[model samples]
Target: MMGSVAQLWRHPIKSHGREALEAVTLSVGQCMPLDRHWAVTHEASRFDGTGWVSCQNFMIGARTPGLAGLWARVDEEARRVTLTHRDLGELTFAPDDPAEAARFLDWIAPLCPENRARPSAVVSVQGRGMTDSDFPSISVMNLSSHRAVAQKLGRDIEPERWRGNIWLDGLGPWEEFEWIGKTIRIGSASLHVRKRITRCLHTAANPITGKRDTATLDALEVGWGHCDFGVYCEVIDGGDIRLGDKSEVL
Candidate 1:
């Protein structure tokens, strides 16, 4: 069976917002370009600039639900990020400067739970994309599986809950699991399937509202007996991936 890229996304700032892309240049040993290259570190969280850190240190949707509603765009050349929210309107800031981190926090402070650490600073490593997986990763999801979950829930769910880098259509529900330990040729790029992506509380939050409206983990448990939805892939060969590009299990 064959699948085709349905959408491409890059989150310039980790857990802050999502940027929809028509095409992206992916490379071996890296996540999507400009994806998760910067993150807002919370107070008391220890994430040094030297290596990959766990997502818990960052202000993500799971911890700050309002962040799920954020829509962002990035100008890589300009190193500028713009985020929009229905409640917050829009704000643009440079993530690299120490002076701008406080403003970024001010914009997001409304969403922070009182118990959670307050946003303190923005952190980044120029060449490495901080990902959920311990190693560098590109998240991929099957659209058919998303629909199947929606069928189980009897309503539609947003793909943003999964926060994937690649969305593929024309594959069976849960068909991506079979691709584990295999190589996938997507457009001009190749990726090695690393593992099934586990579900998290973030899945229950609406992408537009950030409210815990869906029972995705529950739906997965009832329908599939596991809390897994997507797959993580490691880029093996670098190239451009465009919308509607062929995605093949090689």
Candidate 2:
């Protein structure tokens, strides 16, 4: 056992907010349930919803740092999400509903900059997540690696900054990078580690304050000579993955 599952998170609306999960069922060749299921496209976006599009077409934390502070709670069965931010108290809505989606855009307008393209619509691609990677992927992060980065920065860093799907504890610093191209089992699911997740400016924004308080990219470059902080994996075998489940390299 390399480590145990320490936390699970899903972002129902891409780059909008993150929600914590205690357990989730994984499907082969798919992203974590409801992760990035919906994305808000800007007025200038050419995303016709015919297929996956690039992140630049949407409103994201990298471009709009205030979005990092948003947190969410999803009711999967109801297909509804409730989002909360320090500036905006709370809003519960069905993202797929056109009327509600319009309201969402209005509510979130203040957080976005006027110079940037305005958020226009909520969109989703059937049977696929709008992940950063072209292929469906789940991100796995190591707690030890996060600690090492924190140590290098001489301050505590929140895991939310990484926006990872699963977090594992008990592995050595940078140990997960060695698992590339390998198979790993967590709970009853098996995943093939694909590649390193190169981070972006979004990670520099603090999730709590939604401010660019840390130089995460610089820290990683200075401490490790790379900006990667996690690994992306594709599920080869599907099953339930829960908090506290053992994670082993197979």
What is the TM-score of each predicted model, taking all chains together?
0.98, 0.99
C-alpha lDDT of candidate 1 relative to the true structure:
0.90
- lDDT of each residue in 1-250, candidate 1, tens digit only: 9999999998888888999999988888998888898888888788887888899888888778778888899888889999999888899988887677678888889988899888888998767888888888999999999999999999998988889999999998899999999999999999999999998888899888878899999999999999998999999999999999999999
Check candidate 1 and list the clashing pairs: none
Model-by-model lDDT, in order?
0.90, 0.95
lDDT of 2 by residue, 1-250 (tens): 4799999999999999999999999999999989999999998999998999999999899999999999999998999999999989899999999999999999999999889999999999999899999999999999999999999999998999999999999998999999999999999999999999999999999998899999999999999999999999999999999999999999
TM-score of 2: 0.99
